[model samples]
Target: MSDRHFSHEVWLSKLRDHLTEERYAARTSRQCIAVARHFLRCLDKQKVDVSTAQPASVEAYLQQTRRMYRRRHGHPTDYKGWQCLHTNGIHMLLRLVQGLWPPAPKAVTPVEILQSEMRGEYAQWMAGQRGLAPGTVSHRCCEAGRLLDWLGERATREELATLTHLDVDGYLKYRAAAVGRRSLKDVTTKIRSFLRWLYMTERTSRDLSSTVIAPMLYAFESIPSALRSGDVEKILAATRQDCTQKGIRDYAILMLISKYGIRSGEIATLRLDDVDWRQEVIRIRHSKTGAISYLPLLPEVGEAVLKYLQDSRPKTSFREIFIRACAPYRPFRCGSSLYRLVRHRLEAANVITTGKRGPHAFRHARAVSMLRATVSVKDIGDLLGHRAADSTLVYLKLATEDLRAVALEIPTGVKA
Candidate 1:
């Protein structure tokens, strides 16, 4: 980017083209170009050459923009959405010209810097030494980060030697108030792992891990959540009707979940090459059991995904099939992002269910549908990638109505 390009109108044409590719409305594009023109005029008056302008100078111009416009620009639909759009429009231009839009990360304190370094080390140890899966490592690291955050200034390695059992108990007690019993138990487990690592590395004077105990758990305590027979269809129908970019991507995702009962992580991690158009099948790698299954590509699903890939998906170099529908386009951040997407779609479609409500709900729902269709238990196990036959049996617990049909009549001689 020549400084002259910024000062000149050469990049304005490029900015307009970029906005059009991103699906910006004609009105919004005009507003953006107008803002860019105004900005260049201001820079000219200030005797600041546009070609050689500093980022700080551009930031100053953006800062003064707030003074020119009022809070409510009288937009009826979005209610203050214009303010955000204006900022975003100008940012788009800056990103187009400079490429490094944000410039740099926010400054961090010494304690914070050390905290991040230790977390990275812990993640590496979990993956390299323990050979844990990526998902397990990520979850454990997040829990450990929580403990370190609670410790605040005392989180550094040298301070580990100064820690005591009271700190462990206090942290657990603090966490207990916010999470369910199962989550608290997981937190305790996460803490013990971190403490053990510290002791093994000789950072801690003693094994404080022995002091951390897990909470009790009951067997078969809660029912697994699932959507009704029609709920999944409702969500799919609603999403399928939406031809927007995000809708197209989300519809493809819902198709995978509903049709094959694959886990969200599998969908998020699915690469473009995973789909075999000639073979008419999609490859699914189980996120939990690490098993791989090839499912036949139903025409409906293949068509939906094909439409998204061709029409709406942003042009990105990511091998992942599903990309986010916004600027700074990227793949979903893993299962949790997909979970949020599914949950929102479920809620928006006015579908409700009790118990666990993430992508697992869709998986369980698929299982129930299979059961209702008289799918053999072995077939269910095979489709869902369950290593243990007993795992497939768990879904039978949710088929209360189907089970009732198979109940044998009790003999009169038998006692209640």
Candidate 2:
């Protein structure tokens, strides 16, 4: 492509589209593109082709520009402050240019390369054979990669098979210090499962899965972080007050979690077709349990969703109901985005919180509310889409009213 094709007007338009696809806000994109345009003009004057532009050339240009500005101002302020502006603009411009003429893949470390290969194979096996969800497979693959990194990068397949209790013990010790108890449990589980797979596939001579002991977890050990009904109301009210496109979308999401007790992943995966307006029900496809169920779409929730879809939702071919509220208008890459949305709203509403900060808090609150209303445990389980009653048992810890009712009364002024 001719360097002239990367002129001021053409480059800015392309950069705008690229930023839109990346989900940047319009104002921010324009500002970045303006800076990028200036940088490109400088390059054009220097008879430099952007495609062949190196980082050193960009850095040198940035330094020269700073010196000129510094000379005019004679100010002792940090130069890095404005230098960052050029750096960011150059980064965005180069990124756009590089995409058109893609660069060669960066060289990978031996350990990373080996881990990548193992992770790919393990992910395929988990998905195809075990019928694991993509999220689960991805997490397990990450753990497997971490384990391989712990083992030497140069270790051979034969050496891997020779892993003993001592190696496993050391890995667990190092991991435990690095993570919380819950995270440690997950690491141990993934390690054990990976070792089992290796042995079953004949990569190992001995079964080492049995050697990795998991941390024992007691039932109802942790307190359920259920928000008070008033706090839940506060969060909903905060969303309602914003009256912005993003607020509308957030209101609809909060309504789903609070009313139906659905998981964040379920909300992220929900599509336009999932809501049956004629039947006034919403179908949930649970990612964890892989179960499909429907619930009555409460009028408030329905209205919130309808308002968002009709007004705030972007025009897109994507079937998913929730998309990033900015351009290029794509669905969320992961469920964590939903958690951040809830956290932001919670902070805005000044709601007191502890432990969990995600949509699961709303799920717990839903269960506790149901229990207070004397709803059957089985019905609460059904509402939460719990495949087993045991899964619903955790909410019992938060059933303070029920516990208060069963407590023995003490005589007035009596001391223990």
- C-alpha lDDT values of all predictions: 0.83, 0.84
**Per-residue CA lDDT of candidate 1, range 144-253, in tens?**
88888899989777787888999999999999999999988888888999999989988789999999978898755666788887989999998888878888989999
Q: Write model 2 residue lDDT over 1-416, tens digit each, in one string.
A: 56485465676788787787776777777778877877776778787878787766686687677777779888643766776756765787787777632354342876566557777788899999999888789898888877777886534576877878888888899899999888899899999889888888777779888889778888879878989899999999988999999999999999999998898989999999999999999999987778899888889999999999999999888999998897668899777778889999999999879778889899999999998898988999988888889888889889887898899999899998
Q: Determine which window of 10 residues in candidate 2 has minimal summed lDDT.
A: 98-107
State model 1's lDDT. Answer: 0.83
Clashes of each: 1, 2
Please list the residue runs of candidate 2 whose C-alpha ends up more than 4 Å from where it truly belongs after superposition: 1-13, 16-29, 34-115, 128-131, 200-205, 409-416
**Whose lDDT is greatest here?**
2
RMSD after CA superposition, every candidate: 5.2, 4.6
Please give the distance, in angstroms, between residue 406's alpha carbon in candidate 2 and its true position after superposition.
Answer: 1.1
